[model samples]
Target: MKDINYSEVNGYLFPNLKGREEVKVNSYFAQMKLKYLKTNEQGHLFSLMAKNELSTYLEQVEKEANEMYERLVEEFKVKWNVTEKLKERDQMEWVQQMNNIDNVVKEIILKELICN
Candidate 1:
């Protein structure tokens, strides 16, 4: 185990750990996954923490999920005929269709990437 230095602040001692802010993830998918892990996947979460890999793993998850999201959006757009032509043909209909696609894609991401 590595040494943990401490500093006195406000009549309390806190471990002086560097780069702790990296654990504060920004991606919505990543944050959801972290919460899920904390509540339902403690063993895996502990394993990552033991190796000091939680931040790195979450970052990777965010990147992969984002990439998958973009790819899936393109595929769904093609499958649903949500093209520029549709947008030009019927603006209201296109907007509705895109809103539906966005909701469905978010659900897919939550199930496949964030939760699982």
Candidate 2:
């Protein structure tokens, strides 16, 4: 498979999936395949490039998921700081939220990076 480039923005990047902010990214790649990857003049999409590009796009999606998870952790910390001083119960809730985020990020990162 051909390698595709990944772009990052604001320390966050989304995958070039069918939907999401990367719609333009996906469309641009589709057009690239239609123009350059097609075997004929019929503007048909090229399977190889499409597959490679989609995989690269998915990598971006995974990156975004991880970043979102980190953001959630930060949010949880801020919320916990505010509530912890008032109620001890808030600390347990904060820990639970952190654990959840950690599990999600681990699964996604492993799938995107190590397993691949």
Candidate 3:
């Protein structure tokens, strides 16, 4: 049997454990989707498992999110005129613009890939 770790909370020990179906979901998108599934859609997640497509589904979502992020960054850079020249002229402006783009992309990913 696998070992279970415990956490002591106020002199009480509680088993720090997860379920047997431990799918390895990496990347921000995959993690978000996994959390959503575990919290709100266990039946769907288990259905995917029974169909032998959970990994593939997560992988595809991760890939699509990553690709969308990259593409959005490139597009936003061009659209917002965030270029090497701007970066060289003002480092703060470059950073702010990049951060904005990142936030927008993450919002898009959350709505399109994760929440839904």
Candidate 4:
């Protein structure tokens, strides 16, 4: 019996299968055949299908990774802006405290000079 290539069979059955869906189906059948079929012809066909599937999967992963990196960059920018605002608030508080201390010291000096 001639070994059957299920990926080719599927392509014939789903002539309209295109894009990721087609790749996914091909990959799934290729994996199933690799697991269950022992014939040389089926093995070769399945191997080819698997290679195409892997290429498609890698492309999808790369696209997702780029999107995730962009999201992380935006998040980092928001966090940095918040951190800068907090630092500014802290500096303002420190200056206010210094001015209060200076006023208290001036009052003390004036009191002493007037008394003496």
Candidate 5:
């Protein structure tokens, strides 16, 4: 028997098989389809699925981020007795603080939701 190169097989197959249980189960047919399917068609299908999944995830993140930002702003307002009639420097400081907090929250969200 010939020595099978696991790395080669993984490099060739993983992209096609990743997140696809049916293809993993029917690997022989999957290999056949890879031969028959045009490369552009396969790429297009992968791109479409990726875009759909990413958009759905982004929508959820946007909703969550918006809610969190609103809550944070409300809390800050109540905690600091902030009003719409604040002085210019105070308003700028508040905006800067909110932006800093937002950056931290966004990092956490991306790490938790997208990197995991």
Candidate 6:
């Protein structure tokens, strides 16, 4: 199998918005979306078919949202780093941190998308 580097991913990387700030904002929005969706679905806000149809639609949305969220976070990791210095080799650490942040965002998006 061929190995794929981070830079090879589809889409342009963000030159800025590295570290915790970006992650935090994304996470917050994802959570909000999840909460809203859950409430709406539970309350039968759609007023369409039965619960089965509503649940199916919600599942599809959640799946797409999760995929997008994961891609965005991976891109962020590749673009942002603590330092470019070769000797220091801290960029990898930054990448790891970014991955952690991505997890939080993914969870929020999953929940929100399902609910909403």
Q: Candidate 2 residues 1-116, lDDT tens each? A: 85555568789875553332232334322333333323453222234334445445445554565575577566656755535553466777766766765666556544554333
Better of 2 and 6 by lDDT: 6
| Pairs in clash, predicted candidate 6 | 34-112, 37-115, 37-116, 38-115
Q: Could you estimate the TM-score for every candidate?
A: 0.75, 0.32, 0.76, 0.30, 0.36, 0.40
Model 6 weakest 10-residue run by lDDT: 16-25
Going through the candidates in order, what is the number of backbone clashes in each?
0, 2, 0, 0, 0, 4
Which candidate number has the best lDDT? Answer: 3
lDDT of the structure predicted as candidate 1: 0.88
TM-score winner between 3 and 5, please give it: 3
Candidate 1 stretches with Cα past 4 Å from truth are 1-22
Stretches off by above 4 angstroms in model 2 are 1-51, 82-94, 100-116
Tens digit of lDDT per residue, candidate 5, span 69-89? 567666766666555655354
Best by TM-score: 3
- Alpha-carbon shift of residue 17 in model 2 (angstroms): 22
- Report lDDT per candidate: 0.88, 0.49, 0.89, 0.44, 0.49, 0.52
Q: Write the per-residue lDDT of candidate 1 for residues 4-53, one digit (tens) a residue.
A: 89999999999875553347678788898899999999999988876678
Model 5: how far residue 92 lies from native, Å: 5.9
Give the runs in model 4 whose Cα sits over 4 Å from its true position: 1-51, 82-116
Residue lDDT tens for model 4, 1-116? 84433444645643333344254423322343333333435555455555456445434444544454455544544544434555577977655554554455434433342112
How do the residues 1-116 of candidate 3 rate in per-residue lDDT, one tens digit apiece?
A: 86879999999999975444546787789999989998999999888876567888899989999998999999999999999999999999999999999999899989987989
